[model samples]
Target: MSPFLTFKTFYTNPLNIEYFYIFLFTFLLALSLIAITYISGKIIKADKTHMAAMLLGCVFPNSGNYGAPVALFAFGAMAFDYAVIIMVIHAFLINSIGIFIASFGSEKSTTAREAMQRVIRMPVLYGALLGVLFQLLHFKLPPTIMEGISLVASATIPTVMLILGMQLAEIKPQLFALRYVNSVTVIRMVISPLLAALFVIFMPVSDTLKSVYILLAAMPVAANTTMLAIQFDVKPNLVSFTTFVTTLLSLLTIPLTIYILNMM
Candidate 1:
């Protein structure tokens, strides 16, 4: 419940210093996956929309609803703080870098100014910054206010899942037959996690934090990819398909990954 305690330990304790590296690793791993997928799509002579779809799918993971709960279950509530940090990094990256890539890769020509505007318009980064500021400053709110915040936060996951379902309903039937679908799936559900595992091995964090990282790595494509794709007109159907497929695939992969990590 006291994430500030974990954040404090992260800075003051030598053994926990790797917590800073976790943010770097998560951001770099995501960028690396996006780069790999984008290049692979180019090498394969994929179309603009398909390549954009690859960016959307491979660059982001469902770190919130899917990753948080899995971390809570596998590593308990303490690890949930690590998951929150990962998700915060994930959100910032998705809002800025993710949007830029999706916009640039799309069929339309996006200027740097436009991209900058899109990134600035996103509130996640500001929210994350304010949250950390409050934690660092030991700012306390009333219990009644905290309770209301908790109540609203509890609805986030289900609301995201509902949005995903609605996005699926918007997918055209023809996109299902696209040949690039398998490639997107492979990049998202397979290669991304493998890259994350390498980071996990090298990270100096505790075993529980390592487990949280790996589990978050194995999560499905971000459900928000669909919304971003739709917003940027960046091959929404393919993005939605990859989101749906990767999420369905994770039902098997995530649990199996948890068991494997335990055995390791």
Candidate 2:
């Protein structure tokens, strides 16, 4: 079964409310990470454009495609539930908070009303809400419609990755020269997992949840951040380059992290 289906099925269980702490945990952790990255970027004297790019590339991860598989490989299929749950949270946060941050930090000055409007209009937020509602209400979609939706959902990650690769190809000659790209890469692929370890070490959740958080955090920058960048005109090339760099580096870093999580 798909990771998202696994996630939905788990939540739809009548007794699943007992595990709601995991959602709160992820929400707080995501906010903290975003805040820390935003402050750090400012402290480093990054310009608004770079700061926005840093927040976009560093705070989010490729939790669906890259993270879920890694969770399955490293911790077994049972643990995939946690990975998918975190992915859902990440998606919601990216569409709402991530978009707000990007808008606030955009090169063009934006008023509070405009930022709020952007977040409100993001379709991903609505989709996330509807997913939860459907699961909770036990609303069964028509078979053919569900199948088409599944097909489209399955295509999200690969499609974003392909777009990222193309954007990177265009920026190849100046990839390294792109301001804030390296710092964003390091923060996303390296510091994120480290912070996840620290976050989980003090939590009272089960080891399975801990493993999922670490693996999810260890994922590379979200490829869809490039799409957000392009959509918001928030330094698309720099964000895309950061996404490419971090994903390329995660091949080594993810395994290393899986080893660390295994030891814990």
Candidate 3:
């Protein structure tokens, strides 16, 4: 079959329901983490330290920087819409929800107003908004402009990967203990994607959408998690480790997800 036919076939297949399952699972999983943190903070009377780490792991995924590149390579022009959807979801979560959670245990004690400001300042939001505006206006960027933007966006992935590797190489020995870091790695790299895949299976979205959602869910933790950790005085080392391990392990997990997607 031709590439388009293959995609069409994959999308139309009944197993495509798995996409909705995955999306819901990932979404619920993040929400659950927020609830857990809030409860732990209130009842268990836990300190902000643990809550911070889990929050970072729960919310951050390398959907835009890495997933977009992979989707473009695999899905061609369709990747643009997929990337947009992922960005929209991400912006909503991070701006409205993730920012609220991140504000806690943070020295700056960000109010709702401050969080809204931060949300507005997000570069990904800006880029996605402009891209969508141009798209909706039926305005095509000049070839040169399009090429320049694509070129810059294209570099985001590999550079991030290399930086992640280098960052992992620099991790402190104390931070490598299984007791402190193993659960974060497993949850971020393994459980999160598995749940996302299952969630995608049940949603009413299109088959292509299912595939895109699965791909986004399976992505590694976002590098931005570390930045958030640093900015909020969370467990930066733990967040960085989770990001590193997930990104590294994704070499295997992502291919498996692709195989499963093909079968579906």
Candidate 4:
């Protein structure tokens, strides 16, 4: 069978519904982490390092590179609209919440203007805008251009995953046990996604929207979080470790999430 057919069959299969429910459960777990972050911030008095790590963990996802392809593989063109919307939201959160957290307790803080500029300049933002514009205009890329984009974009996931693995190899296992690191992982990988899913479930969203929200929520922590941590002088190691932990954990969480959502 063709890949598209296989993708369709998988979604339609009775077993797949179980996967969907798992997605829902994981998303709820993620929301719980967000609450933890807020309460922790208040109780612990918002230490710069801890706050930054928590923020980095909570915001951003391996969406553009990892998510788009996975959506395409599992749901084909049917999933495109949902994927695009989630990507837009992801970009916004990274620029706003992610930036705020990274800047906390830092001497060289970014102003609103700087943050806006950074968001505007992000390639993901431009790519998503262009994708939506093209869809709205009903403009089609040349076969060659489409093929090229797909080929280049396809490399993004594996390249990112490999880099992430290498980075993870460098982490001292001890860091994983740190209070801040553990807190960030629980929030980023579990709480944030859950909140996003709950929003999707209650809102009058279409199935496409529901699927996209769940998929985006299930994504592991973005590698960019660590880069931002380094640039902003917010505990890069903590960010990296959180990324590693969440990404590794997502192997179980993501598949289960998809299963559960399918059932629901």
**Winning candidate number (lDDT):** 1
Q: Candidate 4 lDDT, tens digit per residue, 1-264?
A: 112222222322223243344344444544455566768766656676767677677756777556765676666665753464455455566776677768874667789888888887765656654554565566666778666566665555466547666766776544444667666666666776677676676655457657767777778778777778888888777777777778789888877777777777
- Model 2 per-residue lDDT tens digits across residues 1-264: 243453343434333542576677677767777787877787778878778878888888988667876777789766766676677678767877777777777765556686577667755555656666777788877888777666765555565446545655664434445347767877777778888888777778778878888889888888778778887788888787777678778888888888887886
Candidate 3 positional error at 178, Å: 3.1
lDDT of 2: 0.72
Candidate No. with top TM-score = 1
Prediction 1 TM-score vs. true? 0.83
Model 4 residue 125 CA deviation (Å) reads: 2.0
Candidate 1 on 29-120: residue-level lDDT in tens?
98788789878888778877778778878878888757876787788867776876788678778877877777776766667787678667
lDDT of 3 at 77: 55
- The lDDT of model 4 is 0.63
Least accurate 10 contiguous residues by lDDT in model 2: 6-15
C-alpha TM-score for every candidate: 0.83, 0.77, 0.73, 0.73
